[model samples]
Target chain A: MLNLRPCTLTWLVLVSLTLMALAIGQAGLAGWGILALLLVSTFVKTWLVAEYFMGLRRVALRWRLIMAAYLVLVLSGIALAWWLAARAAA
Target chain B: MIWIFIYAELLVFGILFLAYAFARSRNVVLFNASQLELNRTAGAVNTLVLITSSYFVVRAVAAIRADRAEACARWLLAAVGLGGVFVVVKLSEFAAKSAAGIGLSTNTFYMFYWSMTFFHFMHVLLGMVILLAVWWKARQGAYSASEHTGVETGASYWHMVDLVWIILFPLVYVMR
Candidate 1:
């Protein structure tokens, strides 16, 4: 049941490349907005990898939920650290 | 279960990523300045390469599901070839940094960068080994559409390596 459709896999690849482009475009900009955007892209790409490429797409819903929550926790930790750093510098 | 090991690996990398964030928070200026010196283009290219390899890996697994052993082996080999590309790109990036006299002791930021990426680099190597073994077995008709768990297991680990890099690229290279 781990048969991911070809179209879906191709679409995920395109989405990831587009996200990379967005990150590169915003790399030199200095602002919370840019930072948040990069972090969100990381989140989305991570989820796509976990769900599709890792063949977790049709697993038990609980497993999917757990991975999603763990992802949120990790990204949120990084984001919170960045926010705190910015505030301290301010 | 391989799935358990996969999740465990994710948890480990998650902690390391947070540790990086915590370190960055302490000296934001140092982290930002050091980040400016990294080879972002190489990092980006490696990201694309890893994701492409993951796609190839998916194709390999799909091939096995369809009972196409030779096609599956070919796809796995293709993924391994992409992994080689990632190694070349990453080594060049590392060599460039070293040519400038950068090392683990260069700064706190570089320390994290070197150690974390190197750790992930090791995983990539290990994943390729697993893939090579899988490819050999696959070519020998060791698996079929109904019993290709070996292919799935190898692909799972490779994807885990790819997944870590996906989060790592933006977190370390692009985010400010």
Candidate 2:
């Protein structure tokens, strides 16, 4: 049940690309929204890589949680910095 | 042990990411302006290349698990070929940046850019070496469905490299 088909991984890659393009294209539209979108997209893409491509899906739940938390910690720091910088600029 | 190494590598990069955020917060305007000078398209392309290569690696592992030694070698070779493309594309991107007089001392952002990406570039080279070794062993029929830890170990390391780039691309390129 934890199998990640190659086709599924390919689709995830394309979805990530689309998210990247959207984030880039809409960067100037709304600063906070763009930052949030980019960070969320980053977290999602990373989860896909870890769970599917890296075969973490077949591993224990604890390991998956650790990976998820690590990603969140890093991205949250970045999102905070982005928000702070925006506030300072404003 | 490989998992330990992977986690350690992730920890190092995580610290760097935090440091980047701290630095960027101090000089938001300069960071944003310097980020503009980057070639997002190149960054995005590298992202695609690495992700596709990672997929190729998954296929290689799958081939080995299915006891297809020749197919496994072919998949690993293809992955290495794509990794070569990543090297070329990254080098070109770096050359273009250098041509514009950018370096580690250029600014805070460029400093992080050069350090993080070059660090990752080295890892890519190392991953390719591991994959090459796996490919050689695979060619010699060294792995079977029940005895493919070598392939799994190498694939795991390569995926770590891919995972880093997945976050690095948007964090550095598109998240301005």
Candidate 3:
């Protein structure tokens, strides 16, 4: 029988996401589109770490939202910074 | 208390990351060029190493939850071993850069690269130490199914370390 726990499953997803990000980097593609994908991948991976690995999934709602907000704020800030830079360049 | 510490640590890293992004925006060309010089393979591999270590830590927690102290200790040891691998790989990366005459003063990108990564590297070392302490207690059968707060606390801290790297890898090495 093949049984997998939540942590094991989370690890599998995390590894897959890491590999995907690596592929994106190696492809040498650049644009807002590519950046978006990378940022999204990052968002998912970090969220997984927070939820599954950190055991925040069973925590109080306030704590979980705090982590969620941290991810959103940081990632959105990154996106904004890049957008501003791109606009300035153009 | 650990959660409070975790939040504080997250805040610190969050500021550093925002600073990096802001600086990159001001000098996208320089940042992009310098990023290209980084060994993405090494960064990717380190990402794998840390993530695997986090998985091991998770296993350690699970083992303790089952009242399996020996298994928990062994799992923590495994995680710590992987942490050593991370240290070795990172040292080699730093050594390679040093051999190339790179330092914090190399440029703006390098300054951030060295400072941020070295800072995180220290945290990895601390996390290893913390895990080792927890493993020692576990080996003595200190944790039980009903009371394994120490294991969870240490595991939480280690996961925080891994979480930061998950962001760092893409932010520094992969994203341009």
Candidate 4:
């Protein structure tokens, strides 16, 4: 919190790198491993954006918990998507 | 809370993005050939603009909190201006691609490209609308040292859009 400014910029830079990696890795990497990597990196970038850049850091506990709850639903959606992808592959 | 909400929104988009990539992975040749037609420069410039806009909006929030409405408005306008540039550049790029015969029906790659960008473009448009509304509110002195969540919240949405673009740009423009 004391160093919010730099932290936000650093978060931005991390997203940039991950974006480039996803972009480049798309053609070169294959199978479930690469896809998993992309998902985790994307999650990290989104987390930073939500925490630092969006000013959610100052909100109360309930709101934070609500956000976490929403994230659980999101994770559920992702799991469903992965299942669908597997079904498609089959 | 707002940031967390933004993350939640991102998770939804992230799933969609994974879906797109997964689809693309299954059609390597078609997507690859289709991706070649994109104008990389447009994507790159848009990335720079959005990041700069995020920084300006951050300043806007700071300015409003400090009771500097005039400075806040200026930064707000700067953010909005970059957003406008983003739309104009995106449309023109789309037009150029269309002229080259790349439309939604072009291929799976283009379907994803157009769909993703058009969807993201709507978000950008929404951000611009919110910024204008905030500017109007600022002009009316609706925000100040203690009650400027409007600007802060708007900035949050704007930053999230830029973050999406950071990933979308490289994914659609460069990865192939």
What would the per-residue lDDT of candidate 2 be over residues B1-176, giving only the tens digit for each residue?
Answer: 77778989999999998888878888977877887777777787788888888888888888888999899999999999989999999999999999989999987899999999999999999999999999999999899999999999999999999889888877777666
| Chain A (alone) TM-scores for all candidate structures | 0.71, 0.72, 0.92, 0.63
DockQ per candidate: 0.54, 0.55, 0.85, 0.18
lDDT of 3 by residue, A1-90 (tens): 769888899899999999988888887778889889889989999999989999999888999999999999999999999998998999
Q: Give a tens-digit lDDT track for model 2, residues A1-90.
A: 658676465547655664565457445443677678777777877888887788888988888888988998999988887777767877
Candidate 4 regions off by >4 Å?
Answer: A1-45, A60-90, B1-12
Error of 4 at B85 (Å): 1.4
lDDT of 3 by residue, B30-70 (tens): 99999999988899999999999999999999899999999
DockQ, model 1, C-alpha based: 0.54
Better of 1 and 4 by TM-score: 1
| Rank by TM-score (best first) | 3, 1, 2, 4
Best by DockQ: 3
Q: List candidate 1 segments past 4 Å from native.
A: A1-27
lDDT of each: 0.86, 0.84, 0.93, 0.73
Report the alpha-carbon TM-score of model 4 versus the true structure.
Answer: 0.75
* Candidate 1 Cα deviation (angstroms), residue B14: 0.8
Give the distance in Å from residue B138's predicted Cα in candidate 2 to where it truly belongs.
0.4
Give the range of the ten consecutive residues with the poorest summed lDDT in model 1 chain B: B36-45
The i-RMS of every model, in angstroms, reads 2.3, 2.3, 0.8, 4.9
The candidate that wins on lDDT is 3
lDDT for each residue of candidate 4 in B75-174, tens digit (9 for 90 to 100):
9999899999999999999899888888888777788898889989999999999998998899899999999988888888898897787667755675
